[model samples]
Target: MKSRDFTKTGPVAMVAHACVLVVVVCLLGAAVSHAATDEADSPLTVYVAVGVLDVDEISSADQRFTINYFAQFRWVDSRLAHDGPGTIRRDITDITAPRFLILNQQKVWSSLLNVVDITPEGEAVFRQRLWGDFSQPLRLHDFPFDKHTFELPMVSFGGLEQQVIMAPDPQRSSLIADNLSVADWRILGYQTEVREIPLTNDVSVQGFVFSFEAERIFTHYVVKYIIPLFLIVMMSWVVFWIDPTEAGSQLSVAVTATLTLIAYHIALAGKLPDIPYLTRMDLFLFCSTLLVFVALVEVVLTSRLARSDRVELARQYDFYSRMVFPAAYLAAAAWALL
Candidate 1:
């Protein structure tokens, strides 16, 4: 009877041990599956928001002028599925699809808009939210205000390979294709206007200002290329002061200067956007060219006078060119600035 009891207990113990092993294996399998799904669903992303105010037409009576602009974002459903092992791998692709909302506020002029008001308005335009995949970590910060903002994300991609798309305005008639990638992004360095348009009449005039902090490259171009070019052409008029016997040499110099200006224009053509209206750069080039042509004409007239022995008249030509050319150039610049 005792042997029968022992034999029954052994079978019962074995069965219990087998059941525990089965439960452990099932739990391990479920944990692995959950981790795999999480990995497949994670990805990184970037977003941008923009705002503009038109203040071109304002009356003196309207003292409370201001425009407020901001942006928010929503997740758009994407067809692409995220399937990757690393957190960076999964999130990097999502950076291509950015989403955001924009808010614009306009008010009558309360007082003259100062530089501080303008600075904040510009800063609000570039705030963005960035997120990482798998880890689901999020980062929120102000977008790089410098020209190099476009190139900052390239560090993650091994080499610079990023694209930029401009947000559109529903209310405006003009459609601007601001979309650009790495190759075209570099051209922004050549852009002169940080904020191209002010508040206009069709839209209520707002006192708010949006301006770009000029980059080093842009500053360098203005000081080194644009300013120096203008100065050189203006100085060419001094050639009129040289002896009329040297008039032929002066003419050659004027012609060569004009040609050099043309070459500069051609070199910059690819850097600028194709637009119907003239840019500030174009205006500068045009004025410089005109001055050079005027110098050429003055030289021709002086040469004729010298041949007739009217040396005094030839010298008078130099005096007028020195005074007239510079004054005219200053007037044109003032008008353009206004």
Candidate 2:
């Protein structure tokens, strides 16, 4: 029964197999062609411009700051083939694969106002003015003496590292140092670099890094924190000169100075978190606090000696401390500076 229909079935089966092979071959060829086209496509270059508008706030404790800036992105799409008598300018919605910069750290970017413009040579521009609260890494070990390179990176929305690249428009926001709004920092200049940040072992994205070089102005810290703390240290020294026979007055002065040092430290530390490591300011506060505590301890020891009728030894101890304490404090301060 099966042999009787072999003649009709043989040609039909061969034709069906032929069609399947042709379809598979066509699909494989199309895939190879698509990959080759992607490899041949030139990388889109995006030029970025940034303008420093204002600084809203800076928090060392949080390692973040909020600033207002104007940003622009310009690029050319050689792939789009359109023939017009002149340039056809349109909003960004008409463009595909809008490459924009995003903050590398946690940020809040809102209230952005943007404009789009296109040129006859396939050049497209997207400019935005926005305020962003951006996280930055802090090197507080140097505190007021620290220098920072604040980096902002721009990346494409849908392009890979091989598909897009970024460069700074030196003619535009390169002079951001001239118009920066923060007084506590002196702008050193700006620089841009191309970077491929790894998202995974097999995937990395291309990005443009914008660095604003700057250093903190230490005048405010010295005037507000250091000098006052130094005065308090000197104030504690006054207790050392008090008569050892008068235990009440010496103890009162020493205790009062120690309390004042504690108060100053508490107030100063209120602005920053109690980090596990010591900063330059912390080192200064530590020196001052130690001086005051040692002075108070000396008062107790000398007062006790005087009570034990060792008046000569107590006077000698006080005289030596007069020379030793200031020298030691000065030495510590110099060491810190060096």
Among the numbered candidates, top lDDT falls to 2
Local error of candidate 2 at 277, Å?
1.8
- The lDDT, on a scale of 0 to 1, for candidate 2 is 0.74
The C-alpha lDDT values of all candidates are 0.44, 0.74
Query: Which stretch of 10 consecutive residues in model 1 shows the poorest summed lDDT?
Result: 134-143
Model 1 regions lying over 4 Å from their true place: 1-217
lDDT of 2 at 1: 50
**What RMSD does model 2 have?**
8.4
Model 2 worst lDDT run, 10 consecutive residues: 170-179
Candidate 1 per-residue lDDT, tens place, 10-106, comes to: 8778788789899899889888887755534554232222332221221111211122223221122232323323212123223343322212223
Best by TM-score: 2
For residues 211-232, write the lDDT of model 2, one tens digit per residue: 6777888898889877887787
As a TM-score, model 1 comes out at 0.40
Please report how far candidate 2 places residue 310 from its true position, in Å.
Answer: 1.3
